[model samples]
Target: MTELLDATDSQTAMLADLVDSVRAVEETIARLSAVRDGMLAIASRIAVDVARQASHPDQGDMAVRSVAAEIGAAVRASDRTIERRMDAASWLVEAFPAVWAAQGAGRISAAHAQVIADAGAHLDHALHREAYAARAVEAASVESPNRLRRIARRIAEQFQPRTVTERHRDARELRRVWVKDLDDGMAELGMLGPAVLVHGMHDRLTRMARTITLENAQATKASTEETGEPDTRTTDQLRADLLADLVLTGSPVGHDSQTGVLGKIHARVEITVPVLTLMDDDPGASGSPPAELDGRFPIDTDTARLLAGGVTGWERVLTHPITGALLAVDRYRPSDQLSRHLRARDQRCRFPGCGIAARKCDVDHTHAASHGGETCADNLAHLCRRHHMLKHHSPWHVRHRRVGDDRGEHENDDTNAGRAGDLIWTSPTGTTYIDRPPQQNAVTFTEDNPP
Candidate 1:
């Protein structure tokens, strides 16, 4: 028992050691992958430059394709070693322009140089130069490339417009002409006009001017200068209040027929609810029964006209010839019959990855109806708008099949008769699959049934 226990303990230690080794290897691999990615970006840029240079006559027989092949071969020397080296070199060249400049100046480490080279790719030359200057001054401070990118983005956003051209135009018109009470405020505002006083002034300034009179009065406070209170009302609020006062007080010209003073101007709006009904085939049900449709639903003028079928707010009722049922407003018999037949045949969208219901789909004729295909149920299939357009415009091919033998020895089965069962979809690259009709059986019995 002791011997067996010792063996088990030894096995456990070996497994633990193995796990530790795997973890260490994984961490190393991740670090190497990150380094390799950086190098690849640099290598791609180099390849592009090399290809452009190789097109010249001076570089006869030397081509980018040949250089790329050599690089590929070197990388395969030991799984991705060359790639890692190239990626590292590329990152150094791309990120640190300042480092390269400093190298020319006989200062800065290779690692520090590489960071500048990588940063250089995304930044403008002037910005890079500025960043380099800042870095030189603050050598101990570590600069993050990500923070630099955010700063760059903020600088770009500053140039963006606060409002559109039309909005600016409207605001200018409102400030210059539509707004009133300009003359009084203009004198207090110094050289600026009344338009500037009303529109351009900040919220605090407008609020203070509105509540606090420039002149001192005989009540409560001894002097207006003694009391200090922050202006609470916004500029928009003050403007609205001022406009209300102007409208309430009659205009200087006095009320006239064209002016229509606030009190004189009168307007009225009327709203009415109409009757609605659901009609059917029976002769007795020809007209709506008072009790059946008795204002149960609120019908607007438009809906009332559609249901009642008249020129103004109602129209004549039309019935289906075969069923003798009241039809929907826009529907006519032959077209509706075709629609019903199509709905019955293709009960759901036929696309391979789609299971949309027929009610939400459009009936698509497999063969074009304009090319003499009958407008019958058998010829139609349900497809949602997106898949319908995809079928019509894209390279996907759909074939409809009614009868087919099961995948076994040939014996014509009557079980599959008359059912439009299969649809074979062929992809652009010639891959095919048989999309079976949705099974109706509650219990799906297969070859091997459970005991």
Candidate 2:
């Protein structure tokens, strides 16, 4: 018995050592990637300078392509791929030096750095871009690349000199649709247009699929599991089928109604509007922050107002004037006060690094209700189905905490101050990670003023 206990202790120590080594290797890789990006950026600048100083200035594109090809051959990559990487590296290193440095120190990953660079790429002023990089890097340090994207976009919008409406007008000209053929007798269809229009179209499709699914379930008189129906398709498959049917025949499969699903079902989207933005008549004169679309990214005030005007239902969300934390929301319907507040506070899944939208998630209790957990805002959070199940069945455990509880650990970080709620998650390995709600209305725009 003594020998077996010693062996078990040795194995546990070995496993812990292996985990630490893996983490160190990951950090090393991130640092090396940042260094490589700097090198690529330098190479691109040199290539451009050489092309400009050459005997023929008009052939600059060809000259750079030749340089790219030469480097690609030595690196075992395609010339076009090398050229693309060179351009991207130049953009990242030049536009967001702070982000690059953060990545070099392994404070943030390459993916996080790229997301920051892309978010601020549209800034026309140097000061605005610099300010954006500073806050974006801070936010990216603690967030996954997916979650950071939304935060970065909001930060970028705050610094834009031109209003979102003007940008949206110019961007509308580029709206288009295309089809790409794929292997195995399949093809992908894509569309690029206004976010409001695209998201609405998708929402309509989802509602139609749900309607059809409910009707089918009623006819069978049982759920998919009990019926053992092999013909039953997933929600995604149903949406695709419905989309193809609607596009080709202007209706869904087996539809006989004159109005049809297309006419009956409508798209729904969540729009978070600032009172100033909504009330302002002049887009250029108003300094209000841009409205948020589906709690993901910024949208023009025009779109937000239009949606607000047309919609029959409205939930008035009141946020803190400074911290942007949710204070209250007017719930007209019964038992909607908690639901609306949770949705507004937790814009996405509260699971660490999860980016699934709140609308698609289930409101889960941090502590089980069956175990004496009360049904209140303090004990509730939005979590996707996957994470919700994991919280209940897996080794992971989550607890709700206020902002100041862990503020000391993240000294000099201002991102957490904007969150209305925070969750402390402990992994099976006993490592804890803090997940805070995304910052809402956290616009830093002092850089635009006269110093």
TM per candidate comes to 0.27, 0.46
Off by over 4 Å in 1: 1-348, 404-419, 441-451
lDDT tens digits, residues 214-240, model 1?
222333255556465544556565665
RMSD of every candidate to native, in Å, equals 21.9, 28.4
For candidate 2, what is the TM-score?
Answer: 0.46
Candidate 2, 404-448: lDDT as tens digits:
454433311345442337787665545555677777753333434
lDDT scores of the candidates, listed in order: 0.45, 0.76
Off by over 4 Å in 2: 1-9, 54-59, 73-76, 173-188, 214-231, 246-451
Instruction: Report the C-alpha displacement of residue 333, candidate 2, in angstroms.
Output: 70
